[model samples]
Target: MVARDYGQYDGITQALELVGERWALLIVRDLLVGPRRYGELAAGLPRIPSNILAARLKELQAAGVIRRAPRSRIVLYELTPYGRELEPVVLAFGAWGFKALGDPRAEQIITPDSMTISLRTAFRPQVAAELPATAYGARFGGDDLLIRVQGPELAVTRGDGPADLAFASGPGIHRLISGELTPEAAIDAGVVEVLDGPRILLTRFATTFHLAA
Candidate 1:
């Protein structure tokens, strides 16, 4: 068993300390999907300074939230089971805070726009059959995003894609598709934006995926 270092406040205090920093939760978010090299984490989280990123990783390691995996004599970060246990915590906080506070910016340091959510939740069809083999860039918000897609797994930066279609509806896409938010509402409120792509294509793309609705 991983020993608990905290005596009075016990393990909870240690865990909170590790994740209480400005950028720590995002580190966990990125790592939750899979193990990541330092550079990959840095690329996804541009706001975190190099030194702080290194420190937060170290802190998580010390607190038993994350561990390093051996890779070609280098190390990549992966969450320990204890770390994975925090997913509910993160999600719960997001749910409650977003509802109660009107705007949940406290933990949401970054407002993930439509493009980010679209890629995250959509069905990634085979790119080899759709677009050219040449690598292309996907820009969400102000930054060029990264995802990786393994044979059956879809990741953003490292994933192989020249996706023939792109959807940029942000959070409303998730809501509309899930039936939590209506498509008409999203369109009328301008909460969703479709850029440089076919609306029918997006409609077809959205319907193809079974997203809990």
Candidate 2:
């Protein structure tokens, strides 16, 4: 018989042990988006070695953070409900750490509101007649901006801060987009400030928002 070393740790220690590795968090991040096959996970993470990812997946499954789903004959790894609980934690930590590190991943983040707003700002005329003039809320750098079309449908950019909005409130767009604030909570807490028009107008415009396909 062959033996393998399975080190021991207390409850908290074990939790940390599972999540504390450099690449481990990215694994969780990928699964948070949706369940992925082994190859898909490997493809998404270019830096990690296949063997290392395999080990981490096994560890997470063993710890009950993930589970193996049999699709066809091959097994796919997906986060367990318990594992899914870590989404907010992971996203918060990623947001905070990315800010500190000034990583490129920070630039890629866009909130649903921001995404719609940016589309309006960048490509509004394409769908201007289709969009209504509403006080759409946005967040960036932890500050929320209530975007209102006071004049004509105007083009917007990142630099156009402190502009007139129907109303504005809440945390910055950056956090809200990052799952730091759900759309409902943003309104309930009055953190989402508004300006010129009704917030529902913002919701309406958001329907036309698009992202990089």
Residue 41 in model 1: lDDT: 86
TM-score, every prediction: 0.56, 0.46
Per-residue accuracy of model 2 over 1-213 as CA lDDT, tens digit each? 101223765665555777766677778877776678998788667667988898888778877888999989887888999999886676456545534432235335433233333334233345545555544445544444444553346443322344323444322433333344454565666645554545554344433332221
lDDT of each: 0.57, 0.55
Highest TM-score: which candidate?
Answer: 1
Tell me how far the alpha carbon of residue 184 in candidate 2 is from the true structure, in angstroms, after superposition. 28
lDDT per residue, candidate 1, 14-120, as tens digits? 66566877688878877766788998889778778999898888888987899999989888899999999986676555444433323223344343322333444
The positional error of residue 33 in candidate 2, measured at the CA in angstroms, is: 0.6
Candidate of highest lDDT: 1
**Cα lDDT for residue 175, model 2?**
35
